[model samples]
Target chain A: MLKINDLHVKLEEEDKQILKGLTLEVPAGEVHAIMGPNGSGKSTLSYVLSGRDGYEVTGGDATLDGASLLEMEPEDRAAAGLFLAFQYPVEIPGVGNMTFLRTAVNAQRKARGEAELSSGDFLKIVRAKAAELQISPEMLKRPVNVGFSGGEKKRNEILQMAMLEPRMCILDETDSGLDVDAMRLVSDGVNALRSPDRSFLVITHYQRLLNHIQPDVVHIMSNGRIIKSGGPELALQVEENGYGDLLAEAG
Target chain B: MSEIAVKTKAQQTPQVTGAPKAVTALDDRLAAMSLPQGGFSAPARAEALSRLRVMGLPGPRDEYWRYTDPRLFNVPGPQPLPFDAKAPESPLFAQRDTLTLVFVDGAFDASSSDELALEGIEITTLAHADAAGDHWAAGLYGALEAAGQQPVKRPFAALNSAAAADGVLIRVTGTPSKPVHVLHRRAADAADAVWHHVIRLEEGAELTFLESGMVGARSNAVIEVDLAQGAKLHHITAKRAIDPKVGLSHLFARVAEGAVLKSFSLAVNGTHMRHEAVIDMAGDDAVAHVAAAVLGDGATGRFHHDDTVFITHGAERGESRQVFKKVLKNGATGVFQGKILVKQGAQKTDGYQISQALLLDEASQFLAKPELEIYADDVKCSHGSTTGAIDEHALFYLRSRGVPMDRAIVFLVLSFLADALEEVEDEGLRAEINERLEEWLTSHA
Candidate 1:
């Protein structure tokens, strides 16, 4: 489960408030989507929740499994079962994708006080998972996100999500640069990981992605707060009418 | 009467303005050094000393010294540093199938080294060869170094040739069964050492030469390599001395017809260091490559490293490449000066050079100069130089994946050094180098 209670944040370098008293809660085994226009503080919430720099949390708190996530570093957060699939996955020129993934898997394991996986064991699981995601061995051997297509990057991110298998996942505009076919492939990768004791806080600007990875609950966010909440029908309504009516009604 | 008059004039003009201040320093240096008493190397040593006396130490003013100041190396009787214990040699090579030659403070340790025996190879110490009188090494002694003096000045190389403390001579006539490992150890502090090594690969011969471990505070070395028709030489050097003193070195090579030469250097944690490489392709279809990967941190004290490389294409269809990369942090400094020249009639020549630095902090800095001159109209030559900070986005991306900040930085640093590491042809050697680089980065960063 993920919890955010009246979270307030601002830019550390400037006198600007990004998240103004935002509150939301996603219980276990639920997929929740947040629909918002640009500058409505959707990305800020994801960054703040993941403990990125340049954002100072002024008030309130965010928790995972009732444990405070604000005080932990980003790596520690991931070890505590939190994952963030970035909108733009980074391109590291020299670090191989397989090396990065193996390091991450072992790092999280070590942080969680578990035994490290042997090279043989790791190669087996990685190859199987990669096959399901349509990632070839060559793609896995190359540098992370270097020379990869948009869909390949998204699929790589999902592969990371699958490998880490964190309890709480945050997909920040994962559908932004993906096409319809690519979206389907990526959605299938995400849907396979959906299960009880797992939660997803999907942040998207439209309802198209929700059709592939159906959401159990939909929330409408304006400014920095969630002003509306409903079932999947809410996504359908937003897709048909846009955010203009909702923003005016919320105000 | 005329000789007496000349001696009187020389003594009287000691303070003349025409004689540069460097000459005075050179006199002090000569007084402190003596040539090998007698033997095959005596004439060459005397000749080198005469050349040193003529050129003298680098001038007091360093305006012509592109990026490094030779004043520290020119200091006479430099204060001794507290001698640190000799660091452990690379375990990767110790157990491997290689001929290990150990040197303590630049002096060959006979008892600890393996027997000088190998198929198709003749190995002997410079001292041993000198005592033998008119040996095979007589012809090669200081030959390439004297030839490398054109288009540049290396007064210290002349000094090394003249008063070398200790060195090894290797002559390869056929394929060697294993690599030759030059292992250096430091036993005293502020150890000022000069050494010269001459390696000759005969027609169709091949060799892999490895130099590793730390040296003394002030060490100067010169290696002369001669590759004949269709010969090949792979030379690799790795150093990690951090005494805040100095390390000066040069690798002068003459690559002949259809020969191939590849030299790679890895330098970490040193103060006031400069490594110069001069390679000449004298025969057609020869291939040459020189590369270095350096990491310097000023956190402990002053840290600086400079690499000066020059490659010349003098024959048809010759190819040459130079790659240098450095990682600097905590006020560390790095410099690279590289040049390539293609002679006339050297058509279809290929030359490439690239130098890059990744400054890990605002206090760190990198300076570079890259040049290419081609007299052949049909040659292909390109060069580039760049300096930049580490990618912040990439750092965060690695960290978010559950890798700690320290490990993530190491990964990125290795990534920055990847291009330079690629120059190592042997896969096992490259892997060992990567492991060594990772260990250094972990401890220093």
Candidate 2:
């Protein structure tokens, strides 16, 4: 569903490469996890893949289901079934949670040539999905994450991912600030939306989130490239042994 | 209600008409009209007019007049007011069986107004109310005078009092499910017109008032609203005056106690227009929600200058929320400054204010200031003001999606203004404002 080839991305007007010689592929009907220490460019890959501005594509290509994503806009990427769950979601005041979600979902649906959902139907689905994600009605009424706690924001991100139902999902540190209960609730939300035909690349520094939404393959990323790939056991190994041993081994 | 009296002495001046000198001569002449004598005559009017005259019209020196130049009042043409003409007509609110009060060039139009069939409501032209010994209107008029004991230094309010043909005074003793719509229309020819109105909502009464201004020539106006304890009012003002060379100033307001006052002011077209709305929160648990959207284009300047809310909280537990959004294009300008004053010992007062302006061209400009003055630490108050061009990224995002530059700009502008629009409770009024916004955007595009 998603693929990147020798992608070398850098900040606009800067020579410092943020994603260097990075390559990965998440084929349909499969799940992949990318684990790395801080500054390993995991979030950078997600941002570049999502086509956020200010990040220049220095080299290589990225595609979604065979179509080029690097050439698309951020909203276009979203319309093309690509979702990036941010580590720290942006707070957009004056834009209600329901309003923002509706715009995003409708934008994607409109781009896909599907009939837009009416306000009534949209509300029904949002309520159902929010309930499953444990997002209270009051929370959905607020401005997008305006005063939300860190864990609630993360969970709200998961709720959006579920609402969007993207073809390819990238969770960037989805468990960073979550407590045990919130972590489980967020993981459960993601796991509930998982299916054989849909693919997800959950990016995190810890292995705890992986235990809930187990990935078929785990890739160890360092220095902007994937150095090793292994089964789910590799996540547990990293949790117990830490990335210090992996860096030494990769060297 | 206690009677509030304002004493006055009018300086004698001639009322001149025609030519630039003649214009000032008339301004000075009108400025010279003495206060009308006893028994509801010139003395009462003089008191209010002179008080307004002393403060003088707002000039560039006033901080509030920084962006909107009141000097537009100086014109080299015929004076549009004090003209002899038939009463103006309105078809917008005619379809609904509303208690209609008609005012032409600030003078009450008894022949045009409709008498209400309901009881417990007193609806009459200010002329008739004044003749009927209605002292309530007198007490409320010029009540919010500046310290100089003037009606207001604003030229429009001054003109409204100086040449006010007549005004409509309405009082609701009990809540009226149906509302009274005051349609203040200007004369067709090139004559300056001025109108004044005073509306009062008695204790426990509620009403929704629709007030708007449409002027063919230069016009000035002042309107005041008082909502007694437990009274509620929803006020909507829509101004569409398209003469880029003409100017108008409006000072409209409301006062509430343990009451609610919500207002939405939309300014889409005018040569130069400024509206100052001050809502006084007097009683405990008083609430006020005021929002305004000003869409300006071409050289036809439109100013949604200021929307202010004064929450006394003297009674305790009061709240005020104000939001203002403006879009400036071509050489148009917008200014918004809002302040919330929380009185001492008035605990649990919550106040929030936000104002933003979008400048679309180098010639376009916007000035915004949001302030909070709190005397109690237990209060929650916050205010934010921002002025900037359209978000380049969001513009690019829309354009990259195949939306043309013009359409994308319109979309972003509308989205930027959506917050204020959503605050309007009336769906019809909201739709009208949105349509006006679209019209302005399309013209500029």
Candidate 3:
């Protein structure tokens, strides 16, 4: 469902290359995790795929279901079934969380030439989904991520992913600021959305998140390139030892 | 003593022989226009006229009028424009429960207005009240406007007081069950209209006053409010005008002990528009809040909007807040001048003022002057002003969620004005005003 080839990215303001000759693909019905040490361009890969600004894509071709994702605007990419769960969800001071979600959902529907969801129907589905994530109605009414705790922001991101239901989901360090309980809850939410046609690119530095939501494939990323590919056991091996051995092997 | 020395010094310094040409020209224009006649209090009219003569119309050089030129308003005759008699898509404050008063070309339209009386409240047109003589409204006609003419001069308000042809007088004896709405509809595009409204909330009484619609091509309006001890009043106004219209409104309010006054104004469009407010806290523990949300977009790149506010705490334990927000696009200009003053005996006073603007493009501009004067040592006061473009990160966040770029911009612009909109006390009114804001955004964005 997602494909990348020889991707090279650098900071637009400075001549600093973050992603160099990186290539990875997540097939339909499969979940993949990318584990790397600090400054391995793990986050940069996700941002580039999601069409964030301030990144100069000097070389690369990223496609979603045979559509050139690199040439599309951010919203068009989103409409093409791409979703990014931000590592640090932005704190929008005055846009209500519910309003943001509804606008997003309806905007995508309209772009795809589908009828807009009625407010009544929207409310019913949102309430049910919010209950599953332990998000109170009050939190839904408050501004998006403003004054929200770290766990709540993460959960909100998960809720957005569930609402958008994108075909290709990129989880950028979703486990960084979460506690054990929160990580478990978030993992459960993601695991419930698993389907035959959906794919996830889970990026993290630790293997603890994979324990809850098992990955079909694990890739060791270093120096902006995936060095090794293995089964789920690879995550456990890294957690038990560390990235030091993997770095030496990749070198 | 020193007083005699100062008098001698003033006498020695040769005073200017005559007023500036702009002042004299404005005075000549005022002299040419006939003052409103009939049952108006003679002394009040005389005093207001005298004050207008002395102050004249403010010029670009005036300290308070530095950002907003008063030239457009000083014209001798109304500049004619093609009038669109068709009412707005949705007339504001049109509901069954509210008492609706209509003004056509600055004159009361009794045929279109609702009943003149309501339970617990008394209402009468200024023309009728002035003709009746010795009415309760006589005491308040221009009293608040006269009292507000201190520390700063509002020549336009004085001119409005002296020249307004007709308006309404409202007196609330007790809590009113419904609000009073004044709706202005212009049929003559080139008509110049001036109106003065006086409202008195009796002790412990409560009322809501709502004003909407554009008055005329060249319009000036003054609203005077006197809140007795423990009384409460809520005032909301919305002004939406197309190009080639010049509008000015002044609100003067005095809050007594334990009284509360909350006023909000929303300006959506205009060639040139200015709204000024002056509030005085006369008794201890009084509270006052004044807020405005303005949006200006000139298709021809010639729109201007100004919101000037002055608040004074004259008694102990008083509180005042001023919030002004503006969104300007397409080479439009927005201005805000706000001041907070705490008197010597007004200890424990709390004052807060904030003015912000969102410039949609490089050509759009925002000018703000915020001032605070405190004679009391034990008071809490703060003022802030900011001008910037929309948050790029927030814009991206919304766009990444599949919202179109234009829609995302509207969301952020509306969010910028939400803080000022929150000052509206009524949820229903706030929602209506927000809908109007959304409509404005849809057209401009």
Candidate 1: tens digits of C-alpha lDDT, residues B11-63? 11223255666688788876766556688888888888888887778753433
Question: How far off is residue A153 in model 3, in Å?
Answer: 2.2
State which candidate, 2 or 3, has the greater DockQ.
3
**Models sorted by DockQ, best on top:** 3, 1, 2
For model 2, what is the alpha-carbon lDDT of residue B441? Answer: 78
Give the chain B TM-score for each candidate.
0.93, 0.79, 0.94
Which is the better candidate, 1 or 2, if ranked by TM-score?
Answer: 1
Q: Candidate 3, which segments miss by more than 4 Å at Cα?
A: B1-20, B87-89
Q: Where is the poorest 10-residue window by lDDT in model 3 chain B?
A: B1-10
User: Who wins the TM-score comparison?
Assistant: 3
**Model 3, span B120-171: residue lDDT tens:** 8999988777778778887788889998999899988988888888899999
Go through the candidates in order and give each one's C-alpha lDDT.
Answer: 0.87, 0.70, 0.86
Please name the candidate that would achieve the greatest lDDT relative to the true structure.
1
Model 2 CA lDDT for position B193: 57
List, residue by residue over A150-228, the lDDT tens digit for candidate 3: 9999999989888888999999999998999999889999998889999999998889899888999999998888988
Per-residue lDDT over A79-164 for candidate 1, one digit per residue giving the tens place of the 0 to 100 score? 99999999999988767899899999999999999999998999999999999999999999998898999999999999999999
Distance from true location, Cα of B276 in model 3, Å: 0.9
Residue pairs with backbone atoms closer than 3 Å in model 1 (clashes): B83-B189
lDDT of 2 by residue, A1-251 (tens): 78899999888977788888998999886779999988999988887887767888878999998999998866777778888888877655544688667766776788889998899999999999999988999999986677899988998888888878888888989998899999999989988888877899999899988988899999999989998899999999999999988999999
